[model samples]
Target: MIPVAEALERILSALIPAPAETVSLPEGWGRVLARPVLARVTQPPADVSAMDGYALRAADAAAGARLRVIGSAPAGHPFAGAVGLGEAVRIFTGGAVPPGADSILLQEDATAGDGLVTPTEAAQKGRHIRRAGLDFAAGDAVLEAGRRLSARDIGLAAAANHPWLHVHRRPRIGVLATGDEIALPGDPIPPGGIVSSNAHALAALVRASGGEPVVLPIATDDRDAIAAAAEAAARCDLLLTTGGASVGEHDLVQSALAPQGFSLDFWKIAMRPGKPLIWGDLRGTPMLGLPGNPVSALVCAVIFLIPALRRLSGLPAGPVETRTALLGRDMPANDRRQDYVRAELARAADGTLTATPLAVQDSSMLAALARAGALVVRPPHAPAAPAGCSIEIVDLSSLGV
Candidate 1:
């Protein structure tokens, strides 16, 4: 079996980013930008008030000085007249400063009545004034390409006068679960069959990673059935098959798809709970085959499929992020195969994280996987580590898994 990293490399190297499409600014959130968003107009178009205050010349607004009130300028309205010699304009937040105004006297610091205003404090030049282009200038690239747009990005784009944005199309991932002994949830299960959960779980993972999931019908453990189901998903950016990957009498994914132009890149990987993973290509579409066990499939997907989705979605693609944590218990030396131990993560009073492996880590125990907060990573042949040892862990909650 090859190493896990090699298998992931092979899968990502075979894929390309999805094509770009034009979408409205409202639709751009969570989508990867395909082109930079340049500012069409300068922010704060002109000198404007940063707060509600009186706009006037600094020299005329000394402490206790009185000034004539010329007019009022609220947001979206610009003062037409200039403030000359001992004159002030009533201004609110975002109101453009009138011509000849060099400072603002906050209303709280000024008393206004009888068409005149008195300053309780001295006014300083350029104080409380939002200068033109303070936030951004016209023609500036406000957002860069390849960035996943967020709410803040959308607001910035709107301020930059962008009504539409160019973004990569969300990758369409087709998920197929094959097993004669598995039935869909709420469906009639065979005498010894169990309910299927891999497809739905993987679909949620796809959505969380910013891809669209298309769950295909469950294919039974037969060569024709598997081949036909896979053929139908050739149009998808990537096809995922769960079950029928290991070397069992009924494991027919490789043998069945071989006749249908499925090119085998690699079969097993040196990893615990997921040694039977498969990465390959079906005709022109990339294909990833995961183990039948629920926990194994999800763990493998987190390691391999998430990166593939990111690549296809035009985002920086790499391994899922990991952070350091202290081990809460002793761990034995690992073998040649890499290990991802499900564990509970707790924060100490000192703000450090401690990861403790779960007592029962069976691949079929989905409940145990749900209760796990993190996965303590154990590299191949890693020496035994004691409690309080610094270790690397993948935080499941952070990934929305």
Candidate 2:
């Protein structure tokens, strides 16, 4: 058995980023860039107006001096005429700066009558003109390599005239649930039988980590059936198996994996509720064995599956959103292994996020998970935290695949 962080490190080292491919910007969200994105065109393109005003030389705007108005310029339209001395052009927001114009006086600061303009106050040079390439210059590496694409990042790329982006593809995941005691939900349950929920929880975990999950049917305790399912699961980028990871009499995942060339990386994690975690490679595919408990399966998936998905996407780690918040209540004493306590967050009048831990954290309780938005990480052998203690929190919203 090993610590969760150490186990995660070992699991991630097995997989490598394959390569990058060109895809449309619309489909680039959640993917990491393989190479830096260079800007093809300057943003703003040219000097443009920032407001509805008149453009003229600043020195010509003398007190109470009226100037003849030239042609007008609006967004996407250019003024063919130039502004001569003591002359101004009617310009709206986003309009191009007319020729021989050195400043822009807002309409509020100026009076217009009879096709002429008069300034009431002094204006400075380059007041409201958005300079060319103000946001990004052509040929500049606007987006660096290994950067994850978000909705706003896509907009920035589009502003630079990038229609297609080179990004790492999403990882494909295969889920296998093993056990004879667990009955299918729709199947009839005979004495001492329960419905299968571990695989369903793991499938949601895979999607939360930004990977595609394909759930396979239940693999009974029989060695032949487990072996057959493991063999079929090798084609996916990752495979997650629930149950049969312990060394109990009916456990067959280890023995079945040996024949299929799966080098056992680790078989256990030194953590609460999820001790029987198995990680390795089967025919070059990354595979993980999670404990049968629903919460344990979900926790292991967050620790291991998240990182694996990130590595597959060419990122240093799978994209999990994190934030710093204060603990609002005292927590239980932690064991040698780390603990991720589910907590409900509250924003105080002082603008501080206070995380109050949920009282119930059993390995089988899915009801507790449904109401929590963040998890408070407690390190191994850590003492209880009093109220108003700051800690790191992994937010639920950032888990996009």
Candidate 3:
């Protein structure tokens, strides 16, 4: 069996990023940029007022000084006349500062009368004025390639005059769940069969990773059935299969697809609850085979599939992030395989996180996995750790798992 990190490295190296496509600004949110977005126009195209006040020559506006009132300029309207000596123009916020106006006398600090205004407080030159290109200049790269656009990024792109953006197409993933003992929810079940949950759960994980999921029908534990179902998903960017990946008599994913052009890269990673993982290619499509158990399937997906999706979607690809936390309880020494212990996380009064392993970590118990907040990572052959010992953890809540 290969180590988990080596398996992941092999999978990512075999894939490529999705192609680029054009999308409107409204649809660009949450999409990764394929190219940089340059500013089409300068922000604050010209010098403008940052506050509602009077625009005038700074030297003429001393305390108690009076100046002749010129025409007013509101936002989107430029004062046609320039401010001469002892002259002021009434301006509102966002109004272009008229020529020869080097200062702004705040309205609250000035008294106005018929055709004239007096400064109660002296005006400072260049104060309350937004200079041209204050935010960004034309031709500047406002957004770089490969960045996932957020709401704030959308607004910045819009302000930079981008009506449309070039972004990488969302990766299309085909999810296939297999097993003779599993049936769809709400369908009449076969004797002793359980409802299929792996497909839907993995689909949600794909969406969360910014990929589009195409859920294929469940393939029974038959060679012809598995081969046909996999062949049907050859056009997808990636094909994810659950179940029939182990060594049992019913596990036929490797043998069944061998005759149909499936090439094996590696199998059986050194990890707990998910040792029966499979990574290979079916025809021309990349395929990942997860374990049959729901908890195991989801956990493996979080570690492997999420990073694969990121690489396909043109984002910087790497393992899911982890952080250090104090152990809330004692744990025994680990053996050969790497372990991911499901645990609950809480913040102590000192604002430090403490992770406590759940009582039951059975791979088939989806309820226990749902209640878990994190997965405390235990390396192979590591010594036992006691309460308050520092440990690395994959935060499930942060990953939205």
Candidate 4:
């Protein structure tokens, strides 16, 4: 068996980023930008009022000083004439501060008569004005490449006068779940047949990772059937197979794809619950085979497949984020395999995170996995850990993908 780190490195090195495509800002959310977005127009193109008030020279407003009301400037309607020494322009919010206007008096702080306005508060210069290009200047870089656009990012791009943005194309991932005793949900059980949940779980994972998922039909243990399913899965950019990965007597996925140029980069990783993971290339398309166990498949997908999808989307490949948490229970010494123990997370009175491992860690237990908030990582051959000891954990709450 190979180390988990080596297996992940091999898988990533064999993959490539998806091509770029132009999409409107409305559809750019959650997509990685392919190129830097530059501002095409300056915000507030001109000096505008930040409040509905009278715009006048600051010196003209002394205590109880009255100025002549010359003209009114509502939003989008600017007074063509400038404010003289004793003249004031009635300006509303977002209205252009007429030329030569240097100060403003809020309507609530001033009294307006037939032709004159009286100040009830001191007037300050540049207090209620949004200066030209105040937020951003034209031609300035608004956003950098390789950034996953969020709702706020889309708004910023639109404010920068960008109607459309170039983003990486969503990677198409074909998911195939293979097992002779697996049946689709709602199907009549055939004696010992179990519902196949791996495909649905993997499809959700693909979508969360910003990839388009295409779930293929369930392939039985028969070689011909598996081979036909493999052929159909090859059309996608990446193929994800669940089950028939372990070296069991009935395992046939490896043999089924061998004739189709499936170059196995690695077969097994030194990790508990997911040791049977497979990574390789199938006729030029990258492929990863996860163990059939529901918990194992989801955990492996989180640790490996999500990062691969991020890389394919032109996003940075960073280390899997982890946080330190106190163990709520004792754990025995680990063996040769690195262990990812699912645990429930809680916060202490002092805000410290605590992870309590479930009693049963069977890979097929979906109930226990659902209640897990973190995966405490234990390196191969790690010493026994006692309660209250600090340990590294991959926080499930941190998974935005």
Per-residue C-alpha lDDT of model 1 across residues 26-58, encoded as one tens digit per residue: 999999999999999999799999999899999
> How far is each candidate from the true structure, as Cα RMSD in Å?
1.0, 2.7, 1.0, 1.5
TM-score of each: 0.98, 0.90, 0.98, 0.96
Winner on lDDT (2 vs 4):
4
Candidate lDDT scores, in order, read 0.94, 0.83, 0.94, 0.90
Could you tell me which 10 consecutive residues in candidate 2 have the lowest summed lDDT? 392-401
Q: Estimate, for each residue in 1-401, the C-alpha lDDT of model 4 and write its tens digit.
A: 98878887887888888999999889999999999999999998989999999999888887599999999999888898999988899999999999888987888989989899999997998779999999999998989999999999999999998999999999999999998899999988668899999999889888988999999999999889988998897668899999989999888889999998999888988998799998988889898999999999999998899889988888887447899999989999999998999999999899999999999999999888889999999999999999999999998767852
- The sequence of per-residue lDDT tens digits that candidate 3 reaches over residues 1-401 is 88888988999999999999999999999899999999999998999999999999999999999999988889999999999999999999999999999998899999999899999999999999999999999999999999999999999999999999999999999999999999999998999999999999999999988999999999999999999898879889999999999999999999999999999999999999799999999878999999999999999999999999999999999888999999989999999999999999998899999999998899999988888899999999989999999999999878777
1 against 4, candidate with superior lDDT: 1
Error of model 1, residue 30, in angstroms: 1.0
Candidate 4 has an lDDT of: 0.90
Could you tell me which 10 consecutive residues in candidate 4 have the lowest summed lDDT? 392-401
lDDT for model 1 comes to 0.94
